[model samples]
Target: MSAPLEFTLLHPANLTEAVKQMQAHPNARLLAGGTDLVPNLRRGIGAPDTVIALGGIDTLNSITETASHVEIGAGVTLAGLLASNLPTRFPALQAAAEIASPSIRQAATIGGNLCLDTRCRFYNQSQWWRKANQFCLKLDGDTCHVAPKGKRCHATFSGDLAPALLVLGAEIRVENAQGGRWQPLAQLYNEDGLDHLTLAKGDLLVAVRFPTSETRRSGYLKSRVRRAGDFPLAGVAVALTRTGDKITDLRVAATGTNSAPLLFDDFADVIGQPLSDAALTQINKRIGQAIKPMRTTNQPGLYRRQMVAALSKRLISTLYEQGAN
Candidate 1:
C-alpha cells in the first residue's frame, strides 16, 4: 500500500471562493467528480497537499442555453447532459456523452472529461506494478516502455467529448488565482501527452460554450473494441453545412489516433459532389490518407486508420440524413 496523503478538503460554495482557495493552496488540486482523481490518488499518481471540492459550488452545476449557444457549467455531470434534452446545437457532443456507462455518466463531469489525463499501457499501472517494471518515465524511471528510443511519452488522449467540442467550434472558460479567461477549445489541447492540457498550473476550466449556427449538420462515430461502454480505439466527429447537396463547409476531427483531436477543413471539397458510392469511396480514401495513426492501442495503427475512414463515412452519412430530417 502507498503512504497516506496529507491533504485537506476545502469546500467552496461559489467560483470566487474556489478561486481564492486554489490561489492560497497552489499545491492543492480541485476535486470535482473524483471518478478519476480518487483512483489516481489511491494508486499514488497524485500527491497534492490539499483538495478543493466543488460539490458545494452549486453555481457550476447547471446548464443554460443562450440565444446563440449553450453554456454548460464545468460541474454539470455527464449523466446530466445525457438526460437533458439533447442539444441540436451540438449533436456530436451528445453522442460522445452516450459513449460512457450510466454510472460513470452520473459521476463524471464535462470538465473532467476535457482535462482527462492521458492514458498508456505502461503509465496507468499501480505503484507496485510499476515497481515490478522498474518504473517507467511517466512515473519515476528514465526509460519509456511505449517507445524505448523516443524521448517523449506516447500516452493516448482518450477523451470522447473533446473531438466533438473541437468540431463544434466550442470555447472553454478557465479561472485561476490570477484571473479568468476564455479560449477556443483547440487551444486547450497539446500534442504532448505527458502534459496534454495547455492550462496553467493555477487555471481551472469553469465552463464550455458551444456556439449556435444554422444550416450545419453534425454527428459523432466511434470505433471501439466493443459496442457498449467502450472507449473509442478510433473515432471521428464531423460537422458540415450542405447547400443544395453540396458541402459548403466542413470540420472533421479524429480522436484516439493522436495526442489531441485531429482536425482539418479540406474535407469541404467533397461538397457539390454527388453522394454516390464512388464519391464516398474517394472521399473515404482521402480521409484515410490524411490520418496516419501510430502504434498506441489494442489494435495496430493500420486497423485504426481503416476504422477512421469507415466511421467518418458513417458519421457523414448520418449527418446528411439528419439534414434531410
Candidate 2:
C-alpha cells in the first residue's frame, strides 16, 4: 500500500484554537475520529497541507438533553449515541446508528458520518486505478464518467445517519473563526458531489440537535450486500404520527442514491390517510423518481432506486403497524 503524502498535523486544545487553526489554514482538514479521513488519506484522496485534530476539545464531546431538544456533540461516537437514552427515544436514529459494524461505530463520530465525503466507484480507487480510468469529475479530470455529458459530478452520498435525522427534524451547530450558529441540517448540503457541503471554508460542524419531538412511531432501513461493514446502497427513514388512527404527519428521507441526502418534501397528501396500499405505492413511486442514483457503486443505479423504494415501503409499513399497536 502506498503511504499518504506528507502533511502537517496540529492538535488544538479547544474549539477556539481549533477554529483558529482552521481559519489560518483554510485548506486543512479536521480530524475528529479519523475513521473516514485516515483511510481516504492512505488511499491518496486528499492531501491537505495540515490536519487540525479536534479530539482534545472537551466542549465538543458531550451529549446534552434539555426539555427542548437533544444536543449531541460532534465528537460523540456512533456507539456512544446508540448507548444513550436518545436511541430508545428515537428508534429510527438508533436503527441508523446500529449500522456499519461495531468497531467502526466505536470510533466513528456522528459528525464524521454526517459529513461523509461523496463516493464514486471511479473516484474512490487507488491513484493508478484512477489515472488508468483518466479520473472523474469528483477529483482530477473534467468529465463525469457516470454521466459523461452532464456537467455535475454524480458521486453518491452513502451515509446512514443524515436520513434518519432529517426525518426527525434535526438542526446542526456550526462554528467558525467568526462565531457559532444553528441551522437546519437540510441546508448543510448541496447537489454538487465535488463540493457537496454548503459549509464555508473553516466552518466546523460542532453538534447535531434534534427538536423536541415524540412521534407515534419511526423507523429506518437500508440495503447493502452484507448485513454490516458495508455502506448502504440505498437507505431510508420514515417518521409519522397518527391522530385517532388517521395519519397526521409523515416525513420520509433517503440517502445513498444521490449526491446529497434527500428529504422528500411533498408527503402532505398522505397526511390525512392511513398508509394504505395506494399511499405506499405513491410514496415508493415518488422516491424512485426523485432520487438520481448513478453508477457510483458496484450496483447499478436502477437497483439502488428499486432498493430505496422497497426499503421505504417496508419501513413505513412497519412503523405504521408498530404505531397502531
Candidate 3:
C-alpha cells in the first residue's frame, strides 16, 4: 500500500463549530470512527484534504430518551448500540449493530453505517485487480462490469442500519453552516446506485430521532455468507401496529435489493386485516418478489432473493412474539 498522505485534521468541540468548519472547507470529510475512511484513504478510494473528527465532540456521542422518542447522536459507535438499552427496546436494531466483528463494531459509527458506500464485487478491489478487467463504472471505466448494457449502476445497498431505521419511522437531523433541517430517514436516500445520499454538500448529520408510536412494533432480519462478520446479501426490516390482532399500520424495508431500500407498497393494501398464516405467507411472497438483488461480494443474486421471505417472516414473528409477551 502507498504511504499515508499528509492531510490536515480539524478537531471541533461542538456541532455548530463543526458545521462552520465544514462550511469553510466543504471538501473536508467528516470522520466519526475512521474505520471506513482510513482504509479508503490508504487505498486511494478517498482523497479528502482535511478530516473533521467528531470524537472530540461529547454531545455527538450521546444516546438519550425523551418523553417518548429516542434520540441517537451521529457519532455514537456501533459498540454503543450493542451496549445500550436499545437492545431491550429495539432488538432488531441491536442485532444489526452486532453483525460486524467486535473490533470493527467498536470503531464504526452509526453515521458511517448510514453513509456506507454501496458495494459491488468487481469494484471493491486493489488498483491492480480493477486494471485487469479494464475498470468498471465505480472506478475509472464508463461501462459497468456487472451490467455492461444497463443504463444505471447496480451496486448493492450494504447498510444494516438504514432499513432498520426506515422501518422504525426515523427522522434524521442535518445541519450546515446556515441552518438545520429534518428529513424522513427514508428520504435521505435516492434510487441511484451512485450518489445515494440526498444531503447537500457540507451538511453534517446531527442525530436520528425515532418517533413515538405506542401501537408500533419493529424488527430486522438478515442473510449473509457467514453468520459472523459478513455484510448482508439480503436483509429486511418490518414495522407494524395492530389493534388487538388486526394490522393498523405497516412499514417494510429491504436492503441489498437494489441501489436503495426497497419498499413493498402493495403490501399496504392488506393492512388493517387480521394476521393469519396465509396473510403472513402472502406478505413474505410479495416482498420476496419485489426485491431485485444483483451478484455482489456478500452472496449470489438468486440466493439473496430467496432469503427475503425467510428473513421477513423471522422479523415479523419476533416482533409479534414480543407484543404477545
Candidate 4:
C-alpha cells in the first residue's frame, strides 16, 4: 500500500511571494491547478517537501492583450480560455485547449499543462502496480522497459497545448527569484523524456506570448482513443500565411510522437507554393519521415506515425480551405 502524502503547503499572496517561496525551498513543487501534479504525487512520483500554491496570485490569472501580442497568464484555466474571446482570436489554441474534458478544463491551468510530466504506460501506474511490474527508467529502475537496451527513458510528452503554441511561434516568460527571461516555447523542452523541461530550480512559468498578426491562419488536430478526456496519441498544429493562394510563411509542429514536442524546421520549404495535392503529398511524406513515434502507448508505433501524417494533412487541408474562403 502507498503511504499517505505528507507535505507542507505554502500559499503565496503574489508572484513575488511565490518566487521567494520557490527560491527558498528549491525542492518545493509549484502547484497551479493540481490536475496533473496531485495524481503524480499520489502515485509516489516526486516527494517534494513543500508544495507552493500559485493559484492565489491574481496577476498570474489575468489575460492581457497589446497591439503586438496576446499574453496569457500561466494560471489561466482552460475553461477561462474557451469562455473568453481567445478562441475567436486564436482558434488553434482554443481547439487544443478544448480537447480536455469540461471538468478538467475548469481546473487545469495553462502553466500546469505546459509543464506536465512526461508519461508512459510503465510510469503512470499506482505504486503497487509499478512495484509489481518492476520500476522503469522514469522511476526507481535503471532499465527502460520500453527499450531495455537503450540508455535513456522513452516516456512521451503528452501535453496538447505545446504543439499549438510551438506552431504559433509563442514565447514563454519564466521567472525565478534571481531574474526572469523569455524564450521561444519550442526551446523549453529537450529530447530527453526523464528531464524533459529546461526549467531550472525555482523557475516559474509566468506566461505565454503570441505575436499578433492579421495575416496568420492556423489549425490544430488531435488523435486519441476517445473524443474527450484522453491524452492524444498523436496531434498536429499548423500556422501559415497565404498571399493570393501561395503560402508565404508556414510552421508545423507535432506532439505525443516523441520525448518532446517537435517543430518541423523543414516546413519552411513549403513556402512559395500552393497547398495543392502535390505539395501536400510531399509535405506528408516529409512529416512521416521526420516524426519518430515509440510504442509507449497501447497503440502501435506505426499507427501513431500514420496518425501524424493523417492529422497533419487534415489540419493543413482545413487551413487551406479556410484561407480559400
Candidate 5:
C-alpha cells in the first residue's frame, strides 16, 4: 500500500505575503484552485512539503482594464472571466474558456490553466499503474517510453487558454523574493516536458496582460474526442487585422500539438495578402508542417496533426468571413 499524502497549507493574506511564503518554503507547490494540483498530489506526482494557497490573496482575483490592454489577475476564475466584459472584448478567449466544462470553469483559475502540467499517456496514470509499467522519464525512471532513445521527455502540453493568449501577444507577470518581471507569455514555456515552465524557484505567476483592439478579429478552435471535459486533441488560435480585404496584421498559435504551445511566426508570410483560397492553402500547409504532434493522448499523432491543419484553416477562414461582414 502507498503511504498517505501529507502537507502543510499556507494561506497568505496578499500578494506580498504570498511571495514571502514562497521564498521561505522553496520546495512548496503553489495552489490556486487545487483542480490540478490536488489530483496530482494524490497520485504522488508532486509531493511538496508545503502547499501555498493563493486564493486568499484578493488582489490576484481582480480584473483591471486600461486603454491599451486588459490585465487579468492570476486568481481570476475561468467562469469569472467568461462572465465579465472579457467575452465582448476578447471573444476568442471566451470561446476557449467555454470549451472546459461549467464545473471546471467554476473552480479552475486562469493562472492554473496557463501553468498546467505537461501530460503524457505514459505519465498520467495512477501510482500503481505507473509502477507496474516501470515508470517513464517524467517520473521515477530514466527511459522515455514515448521515445526510448530520445534524450528528453515527450509529454504534451494540454492548456486551452495558452494558444489564445499567445496569438493575442499576451505578457505574463511573475513575482519572486527579489521582485517581479513581465515577459511575453511565449517565453514562459520550454519544449521539454520535465521542466516545462521557465519560472524560477519561488516565482509566482501574478497576472496576464494583453493588448485589445476593436480592429482585430480573432477566433479559437479546438479539436477534442468528447464534446466536453476533454483536453484538446489539437487547438489553434488566430488574430488578424484587415483593411479593405487586405490583411494588415496576423498572428497564429497552436497548443495540444507539442510539448509547449507554439507561435507560428512562419505564418507572417501571409500578411499583406487577402485570405484567398491559394493563400489559405499555403497557410494550411505551413501550419501542418510547423506543428509537431505526438502520441500523448488517446488519439494518434497523425490524426492530431491533421486536426491541427483543419482547425487552423477553419479558424482563419471564419475570422476572415466575420471581418468581411
Candidate 6:
C-alpha cells in the first residue's frame, strides 16, 4: 500500500470546536485513535480534503459515573476502558475491550471500534487489487460480488465491543451542529454493508452510557483463526440475571457474522425459563437463525453460523452457571 494521500489536519481543543469543524467540512473524516482510519487511508479507501483530529478534546477522554449509569467518553481507548472499574461492572465489555493485541487496544477507542468500517474480501484490498477486481458495490463498482444479482453489499462488521455493549443495554450520546441526543446503542447501526451506521452528516459520537445493575452476569467469547490480533470469525456476548435458578433477564448479541452487530430477538420471551439443555438448544437455534453471514472472510458462512451458535451456547451456559450460583 502507498502512503496516505495528503490532507490538512485540524485539532479541535473542545467538543464544540470539533463539531464546528465537522459541520464546515461535511466530508472530512474524523481521526480518533487512528487505528482504523489511518490504515484505510493508506489503502486509498478514502481521501478526505480535511481530517478533524479529536484526540485534543479533553472532554472526549474522560470517564465519569452517576448513580444510575457510567459514561465512557468516545475517545477513551480500549485499554483505558478495561483499566477503569466500570468494566468490572460489566464483564462482557471488559472481555471485549481486550480485543486484538495490547498495543492495538492501547490505541483503539470504543468510538472507532463501534464506527468501524464494514469489511469484505472484495472491498478491503489495495487500490491496484481492488481496481483489478473492478471494485465492489461498497466502493467504485456497481456489482456486489457476494451476491452478483443483488443490489446490496454484504460486507461484515467485525467490531468486538458492539455486541458486548448491545447486550448490556448501552446507549450512546451523539452530538452535531444542532445539539445532542441520546439513542440506544442498538439503533446506532443498520444491516446495510455500505451505510451501516445510522449517524448522519456531521454527527459525532460523544460517549456511551451503560445502565448499572447489581445482578447482571455477562461474558464474551470469539472464534478466530489465531488466538491474538485476528478479527473474530464469529463472536458472541451474553448478559443475564438469574432469579432463583430461573433466568430473569437474558440478552444475546453477536458480531463478525453479519453486516451489523446482531441482537437476538425474542430473548425476552424466554425470561423466567430455567437454564437447561432445552434452553440452550433454543438459544442455539435462535442464533443459527439470526446470523446472516456472507462470504466476507475466509471462513464459510455456514462455518461462522455454526461457530457463533456454539460460542453463544457456551457463553450463555457459563454466565447462567455463574449467575445461578
Backbone clashes (count) for model 5: 0
User: TM-score per candidate, in order?
Assistant: 0.90, 0.97, 0.91, 0.96, 0.96, 0.97
User: Over the stretch 42-97, how does candidate 2's per-residue lDDT look in tens digits?
Assistant: 87798888999888888888999887898999998899888888778888887646
Candidate maximizing lDDT = 6
Candidate 3: which stretches are off by over 4 Å?
Answer: 263-266, 321-325
RMSD for each of the candidates: 2.4, 1.3, 2.2, 1.6, 1.7, 1.3
Q: How high is the CA lDDT of each candidate model?
A: 0.78, 0.86, 0.78, 0.85, 0.85, 0.88
- Per-candidate clashes, comma-separated: 2, 0, 0, 0, 0, 0
Instruction: Name the candidate, 2 or 3, with the larger lDDT value.
Output: 2
> Which residue pairs clash in candidate 4?
none
Per-residue lDDT of 266-315 in model 4, one digit per residue for the tens?
Answer: 76557788888888888888777767788789998899998998888888
Give candidate 2 regions above 4 Å deviation: none
Clash pairs for candidate 5: none
lDDT of 5: 0.85
Candidate 2 yields a Cα-based lDDT of: 0.86
User: Per-residue lDDT of 214-267 in model 6, one digit per residue for the tens?
Assistant: 447888999989888888888998888888889988888999988999987476
lDDT of 5 by residue, 53-121 (tens): 999999999999888888999999999988898867676686546456889888899999999999999
Cα lDDT of model 3 overall? 0.78
- Give me the overall lDDT of model 4: 0.85
Worst 10 residues of 5 by lDDT: 91-100
**Model 2: pairs clashing at backbone N, Cα or C within 3 Å:** none
